[model samples]
Target: MKYRYFLILFTFFTILGACNQPISQTSKASAKKVINAAPEKKIPIDTSKAFKFNDNWVVPKSSLDFNSLGDSQGDTLKLAVCGDFVYSPFGTIKDSSAFSSSLLKNFSIVTRTEKMDNGTFNFQILNHGSSKLIFFFDTDPEASRHSDIFKGEIYDEDVQFVNGIRIGMSFPNFYKTLFDSFPDDLTNNYTVVQIISCVDDIIQTYDFDAGKLKSVKFITDSYWKVDY
Candidate 1:
């Protein structure tokens, strides 16, 4: 009888120990999971609104003199110049008048007109060489009213900008020539003036893609303040 009793006690204790072992292992596993768990991420707060502006924000005057830069070698590559044709900010043409009799002889020209809601007309000229030109003219019947060339685009491989910058030129080379010729002080200035000698009165901007010259533009000074 005592032997059977001792056997029963041993069996009970063994079962209890096995249960305790699992509890201990479970606790250890839970602790490891807690230790290895990743922390929560915190979102950053924007504090720009708290910053204040001071007089130091004023932009300094540019040191470079842009007036001295001359036009490109070929007359066609010059600002407002195309194949045997030249357009000046001061020069004007009457409605439906030919661009140039001399240029018409050498190149086929396609012209289109779009009347805007305002009393103005938008004229687009496409030359045989794929050069595109735009002109804006007031609709007044006054003889003094003439069309003014506002923009032009050149895609010809042979043509280049005043500083030898071309359509396919690498961005680094173009930027070097641009900054070297123009002042680096474009901090707060709205307009880049005098990009070429003949185009001093007009403001210009350059566009690039993947470090390559994409296009050049002549825009109004107020264009900089446009919201997009």
Candidate 2:
């Protein structure tokens, strides 16, 4: 009877040891996964409020000469509105009529017009090699009467900012350029930047991906400042 009791006690302890080993190993693996998991990013600034102007805040502009990119105004929306054309790198594109213009012969200019409750909306896509420029126009009779708002998205390197900023620039250089030109804490320590021009009533966002300037978006303030 004494020998049988000793054998039973040894078997029970051996089973307990085996069970505890897996538990210990599993806990270690879970801890390692937690450590290796990708960290979450902080919440971005409230862009809707950013679009609105504060009493103390003024619009930010570029530090370099507006003419550095050749055209004095560059490809600014303001120029497109007041001047009735976009001074694109490929050419000066005026309106949706560009589909049949010389632009189509040299490059592809895809255009589409849609009817809306407000009025007619026109969109143009200018394809140049691997890059492209997309433009939106409010072709409503009354809308165009007031201002020629040329909302554009640029994937090309040739679309220059009046402040001399360009697409495909290094992220550090883009940040530094904005930092030196703008007088605000908002432009500091950011790989991406958004500038709202109250006078122009336009919002421009510069984005960076993989440490390089990716794309630039130009939109009207009234279009984005809403409860979404």
Candidate 3:
């Protein structure tokens, strides 16, 4: 009888040991899976004063339709302007018959600086035959060896006019904002800032003698360069 009891106890212990072995294997597998999981990549948050200036600067939107004080002349042949110093191919020479001869130019994005800062960008007005137009840079470039011929790509001036024009700016000097600001990792070519612009037909007018000219506005699909 004692021998039989010993045999039963031995079998019970063997079964228990077998069960515990699998538990150990399961725990090891679970730990290994957790170790293989990836960690979240960290993004460098921009907290600089220069970026704050962009807050005060009016990032122009497509909805900012250049308005007119009154009806912009009905049935008159109108020409639309793009944000990137581009004009409608339709000459504003003021002649209905002139409509018969018109060429379309595609809109493209080009960088321009504002009149306020004469540094890399110059905020200047262009006087094309008595009509005045404003130009500003979407991108603020750093001091370059060459003239601020921006590194950002530009739409060729030769392209034909399309339905709309788009303009955007990239701040290449995102890290140079301030002292306490997080250091900018130059290795990562990041787009720290951006602005999108579109061009649309604005209020038309005649000689300044009839000067009711309020503003010129237009619509665009995206940044002038996004040629899809």
Candidate 2: tens digits of C-alpha lDDT, residues 1-228? 999999999999999989877557788999999988969885454333222222323222232112111121222212112111122322444565654553334446666665656666665656655545456655456542222234556566755554456778886566565433322443333455555442345545567776677887656644422110
TM-score of 3: 0.20
TM-score leaderboard ranking: 2, 1, 3
For model 1, the stretches where C-alpha displacement exceeds 4 angstroms are 1-108, 113-124, 127-131, 136-148, 152-156, 175-203, 220-228
Pick by TM-score: 2 or 3, better one:
2
Query: Which candidate leads in TM-score?
Result: 2
By lDDT, rank the candidates, best first. 2, 1, 3
Number of backbone collisions per candidate: 1, 0, 21
lDDT of 1 at 53: 19
User: Once superposed on the true structure, which residue ranges of model 2 sit more than 4 Å away at CA?
Assistant: 1-107, 129-133, 138-153, 156-163, 175-188, 199-201, 209-211, 220-228
Scored by lDDT, the top model is 2
Q: For model 2, what is the error of residue 181's alpha carbon versus the real structure, in angstroms, after optimal superposition?
A: 4.7
Clashes by residue pair, model 1:
171-211
